[model samples]
Target: MGETIDAGGVDLWVERRGTGPDVLLVAGLGDTAEAWQAQLDGLADRYRLTAFDNRGAGRTPLSEEPLSVPRMAEDAAALLDALGIPAAHVAGFSGGSFIAQELALGRPELVSSLVLVSTCARPDAYFRSMTGFWHWMAERAPSERAMLEAFFLWVYTPRAHADGTVARIVEETLAFPHPQSVDAFQRQLASFVRHDTLDRLAQITAPTLVLAGELDLATPPRLGRVVAEGIPDAEFEVLPGEAHQPFQEVPDLFNARADAFWREVGARG
Candidate 1:
């Protein structure tokens, strides 16, 4: 069953599963807790998993105030506090990875280990342009199909496209019940453009694993490398033949790597 936690001013919709050391899963922009279904299905048996919809996504209601990465990080921290969790292994995907970085930097004691997947440390001009296009599509796309088509073009590789994997994902995305609204999507895009953690990464003392897809264009491997280099002693790995959503594209490989990392961290504690 799902629960609604009063995270400061926002009511966050959260799901908890399995029974072990806590592992918090944070999704990307316009994504809900449902985005982590693969991870929950694959890793929940081994570790206690907590997935939540961000303020503007899923059943979480958005406020009129602007959304920022730091605020989202606070919401994550607040959720944990509400549940009486001292700390947990934190894993974040894409824009959610940005929130994980901020959480570690701001509340180091609340993070046991950090996993950043398909994420970037800062938004460059190219990143800005990409998000700008997404924002435009969110507002002006003639239909959901057109928006999905445009998103798939940048999020998946030629291999996924050839194998019909992208098509399946697009269909699932369209059928999702709690899709993000255009205004919420635009807010997320603006927040992404404003996110920059290059100077603050060193403040995060938690052990971090930086995973990137070799074929990802949105946030390329080079960007992941920068993130790893910025965080002291962070490990970086590139998944072969994967795109932006490596966790979904290669579930077995992604789950194995993530499970190993979490287990190692849990053992240390």
Candidate 2:
């Protein structure tokens, strides 16, 4: 079990389990800490796993004002400060990766290593296409079921669609019982759309592992490659037949590879 703590000005939700080197998990846009359940379950036995909901999402208190990506990174750093964690291996997915990059740049002392998943180093014209799709969703105001189906196609691989993970995610989202706040959702979308980290990446010194999904239409392999290449000594990998959410689509492989990267990076420390 875990508890909520006052992080930055928000009531940040934090959870910890297992024992070993600390590993922090950051979720993607519109996702909660629970989205990392697969990673926590798989690596808990061998790592001190920490996962928290970003401000304005999940159980965490909403941001008073819409936050920029750098501010979100600061919120993450504040959460670590509240927990008295000096440093830890940090992992982030999608836009969360942008936050991780900022943490490494702004608070390097608190970051041991980095695992950036399904993210770009900088916002490019490709992000416009993805944001346009989200705007389309906003305009449609489809039923939850319909929204879930569209998002599933956008985030998961064809294999996951065939195996029913998409339906399972939809069911989980629907069962959560909370009404979706369209305003909050739009704010999260705008944050990513406005985030551009192209020049900041070269300043990141954290040993990095950039993961991508071959079949991902959003944040495609090229984004991962460019990001990895930007950081000195960064490694990159692509999960075959996977989409935007590789950890969800290929949990076993994703966990093993990510865990290994963390281990190797931590060993250097």
Candidate 3:
């Protein structure tokens, strides 16, 4: 489950599991490949699952300078090339979704299909404020624990926040052996805000699925609609009673919708 690829002048860490059609999982800001632990275990039996640490995070060494969202997208393609995978069914959540769109638009030949979850094409003022809060916590918080607590609060719904999910996320955040730097996080945040694929989404030729959680204040349901509307052949699925990370909160429902869409599109392809 370990692979390395040189991208943007840095060595990036990549992991994979299971065996079948390639399915690459991309994570959000401050997130590592382990963020897809749920999906890796859930979907591995059905597909060739691959996940990687974005530049300057996780096992991947920090970049020499800040990275742009499009650069991160190219990094993904580079990782796939290093693995000798020409194309993959790509799925991304949050910031990862933005990179996925960029991948589809910029490297159309490498994306066989796409799943855009809890994502948006552009960052509104509110989104900026929320991400700004994360930046503040990562830099100025009294402790990493406090910073993670605040992050869990922002990423999850009220139900999850109250149901010990926040505690679980905090625990996972602490378990990361590698330390994260505020500078790296700021670079990623700035790149996220710069993401605006609205104008280029129409050029994406892959069959796309836009899925959202009902209570996802982070990205909201309308974000999913915007993506679905932009692509000529995209489908939207709204899961009730779910929040930001639906694939983790409700794996069965998430996989069913995704599996069905992949099947439908694979048939058409």
**TM-scores of the candidates in the order shown:** 0.97, 0.96, 0.95
lDDT value, residue 60 of candidate 1: 96
For candidate 1, report its TM-score. Answer: 0.97
Residues 185-242 of candidate 3 have per-residue lDDT tens digits of 8888889988999887899999999989888988999988998999987988888888
Model 1, CA-based lDDT? 0.89
Off by over 4 Å in 3: 7-9
Off-target runs (Cα >4 Å) in candidate 1 are none
* Counted clashes in each candidate structure: 0, 0, 0
Score candidate 3 by TM-score against the native.
0.95
Model 1 lDDT tens row, 97-175: 9999999988899999999999998987888898888988877889988898888888888988899988998898888
Error of 3 at 54 (Å): 0.2
Give lDDT: candidate 1, residue 10.
Answer: 76
Worst 10 residues of 2 by lDDT: 177-186
Off by over 4 Å in 2: none
lDDT (Cα atoms) of all candidates against the true structure: 0.89, 0.83, 0.86
